[model samples]
Target: MSSSRYLTNQFLIAMPGLEDPNFFHSVTYICEHNDNGALGLVINRPLEMQLGEIFQHINIEHADPDIRQIQVHLGGPVQQDRGFVLHEPLGDWEATLKVTDRIGVTSSIDILQAIAINEGPERTLVALGYAGWGAGQLEQEMADNAWLSGPADPEILFRTPDAERWRAAAASLGIDLDLLSGEAGHA
Candidate 1:
């Protein structure tokens, strides 16, 4: 809403005063943002389960020892039982949303299977569920100063630890979130 431009492939960092339990101190990676609606995944809320457990539940024998212990994340509140995989390289999957030239989201079982066998994209963030907003809903929220949109850094998605992602994403804008007041205006 700031300039009539969409926030596709951006990171929506929760403001200091965000009271919503689902979004407080959260960092969401916007996979698709446009005229109809927007869909994203919370990048920092890791669930109790790990990649190995998820693969087992789905009856897939995971072969990637390096990522077997990688914890899955709670992407958002909606579709809590469904799984989403945010990765790079825009590979051909049964169902996918190309977020940017370097990022893509896949919800297909095939992609999961590929990942279990170590044949998937080089980097992946396994998450359950996703965040969704109706047409103009996200823009309105931004207008009300509920969030801060910034460039999506793949490092935050793949490298940074979850406990620190919220602060790190906010810091990516050169503003220390800890120093911000609870009562903020437009971001």
Candidate 2:
């Protein structure tokens, strides 16, 4: 595959030995990639907070009794204060990016309100911040083996646990992350 190919709707699974704390053993869903740059959300790094905390912070009273059940992830290293929603059943929102036929990403308060009252998309993953790369940066990372690219699988995104997502995403590509050698050498 060409390193310069558009990666929208694909998954970027971080390889082992990635020392950067923000991306160590991470699985990011590429929402946009092109000549300009690339943007994605790290899908695994769950934070200590949940949707309830977010609603309260934004002055949106949440009625869902299971609000605490929701998870909030650390999307990436940039814009850490903003919220981003990766969801399904693409619906109209103040601002939304249809990442795929089954997935969408929203960065609007209206979507958050819908989620607060249980009227939001059925499958949702809320996150803060997002991973970003300047022009050609992502391709360079790919060439360096910092990440393995794969098709974005919603099952792995919504069904897998936070700590297991990285490995699970890699598994989808028939890769056992445990077996990857950290040393840069070919046998």
TM-score for all predictions? 0.94, 0.94
Candidate 2 structure quality by residue, lDDT tens digits, 1-187: 5654888988898888777898988999999898889999999999999888888888998776696469899999999999999999788888998887778999999998888778899899999999999999998888787888889889888889888998899888888889986653211
Superposition TM-score, candidate 1 onto the true structure: 0.94
Q: List, residue by residue over 59-164, the lDDT tens digit for candidate 1.
A: 9887768768978999999999999999988899999898877789999999988887778998999999999999999999998889999898999989999999
Error of 2 at 123 (Å): 0.4
* Clash count, one per candidate: 0, 0
Which segments of model 2 are wrong by more than 4 Å? 1-4, 184-187
Residue 13 accuracy (lDDT) in model 1? 94
How does each model score on lDDT? Answer: 0.90, 0.87
